[model samples]
Target: MSTLGVNTGWRARAACRDHDPELFFPTAHSGPARAAQAAAAKRVCAGCPVREACLRFALAHLPHGVAGGLDEDERRAVRRRGAVGRPVARPGPRVLARRARAGGCSAAQVAMWLGVSTRTVHRWTAGGAA
Candidate 1:
């Protein structure tokens, strides 16, 4: 099954499929070592047929790895700039309700977790808003 709405069939055509997975997950701090590893992984991505799809998936899911020739920092820049011309995904009302029920949390607590106003959470719970 596809994870995070990504098409896993693309993996078969990815150039990095046979490479070391570590090359895609560099440390947080930037340095020569990280740069080299990321560059190597990017080289593979540059030749992959599904590079665009991989990047889109990474941007949507915020995965921790090099994808579509971009490392974490590059992906963060894309997200911050909204370069993809698509709105970032947000948790829907059903997700909020599930979290509240699973955690036995109140609307305010759910709002805090969702980074939305408590009134928004209340509205969602009442089915007046998403």
Candidate 2:
């Protein structure tokens, strides 16, 4: 019963909780092993009651691995489709600097929050370039 309405206790009922963590995060060079592992993980996710919540969380924060019966690429596709009607504008350097100063966060933290790169945040913070 968090603010997100995701039951924390639901994790105890997850099938993959006791499994190897590596199975969920396959590398690009994994080849067949990746498919096999993703399938296995998806099977586990299929029976989880919090599957939707898991997917939403993955799309927002995890950014990698097989979650809620979908892989990273699948989640990325879902996000793209979800944003089809609404275009997101990138924050300007002044906005980034303001957020960093107000939150007392580092360039890397601000970059991650803005979905940019650490180098980009550095340039913005340093007033070098946009």
Local distance difference test, each candidate: 0.67, 0.63
lDDT of 2 by residue, 59-130 (tens): 676678998667887777778878522332334546645555444566655565556788877666664332
TM-score of each: 0.58, 0.52
Cα-based lDDT at residue 94, candidate 1: 61
Cα deviation in Å at residue 60, candidate 2?
Answer: 1.0
The global Cα lDDT (0 to 1) of model 1 is 0.67
Best by lDDT: 1
How many clashes would you count in candidate 2?
Answer: 0
- After superposition of all CA atoms, the RMSD between model 1 and the true structure is 15.8
Off by over 4 Å in 2: 1-9, 28-30, 83-130
Clashing pairs in 1: none
The local lDDT score (0 to 100) that residue 118 gets in candidate 2 is 83
